[model samples]
Target: MSEKRRNRRIKNRNINQSEKSTISKRSKIIWIGIIVISVLLFSSLLSLQFLEHFIIVD
Candidate 1:
């Protein structure tokens, strides 16, 4: 019975560790995606402003 309890505790600890790693990985992916999207949006806005200036000058 003590052996079984020990095994259970080890399994639970491993599971918790894996879960923490997965959560961190997921958050990292999400942050990367958000950064990419924001950069794209900023570039597009800059391009639009440049085009508008050109149109006004012409």
Candidate 2:
């Protein structure tokens, strides 16, 4: 094996690792955003129900 071939292989391996980590981080961020949105939506719904049950609107 030559030095150039060895270097190319190492470079390719590093790039693959970088791509995998980038994908993982992006997915984590997406999941966090979804969870936050869901919490906010549920809380708003609960508040609306509470108001309807306890108060009257004219």
Candidate 3:
């Protein structure tokens, strides 16, 4: 009975580890998306200033 309990405990630990790994992977993807969006937004804001200056002169 004790041996069976030990095996079950190990199996549960492995399952928990796998779940944590999957969660981490998902979080990493989310962070990458956020970074890309932020870069695009900042670049557009920078270009808008240049466009405004040119438009006023023209």
* Local accuracy of candidate 1 as per-residue lDDT tens digits, 1-58: 9999999999999999999999999999999999999999999999999999999999
Span of 10 residues, lowest total lDDT, candidate 1: 1-10
Candidate 1: lDDT over CA atoms?
A: 1.00
- Ranking of predictions according to TM-score: 3, 1, 2
**For candidate 3, what is the lDDT?**
0.99
Candidate topping lDDT: 1
Residue 42 of model 2 has an lDDT of: 100
lDDT of 2 at 49: 92
Clashes of each: 0, 0, 0
Tens digits of per-residue lDDT, candidate 2, 19-38, equal 99999999999999999999
lDDT of each: 1.00, 0.96, 0.99
Structural similarity to truth (TM-score) of each candidate: 0.88, 0.84, 0.90
Poorly placed runs, candidate 2 (over 4 Å): 56-58
lDDT of 2: 0.96
Q: What is the per-residue lDDT of model 3 for residues 1-58, given as tens digits with 9 covering 90 to 100?
A: 9999999999999999999999999999999999999999999998998999999999
RMSD to the hidden true structure, all candidates: 1.0, 2.2, 0.9
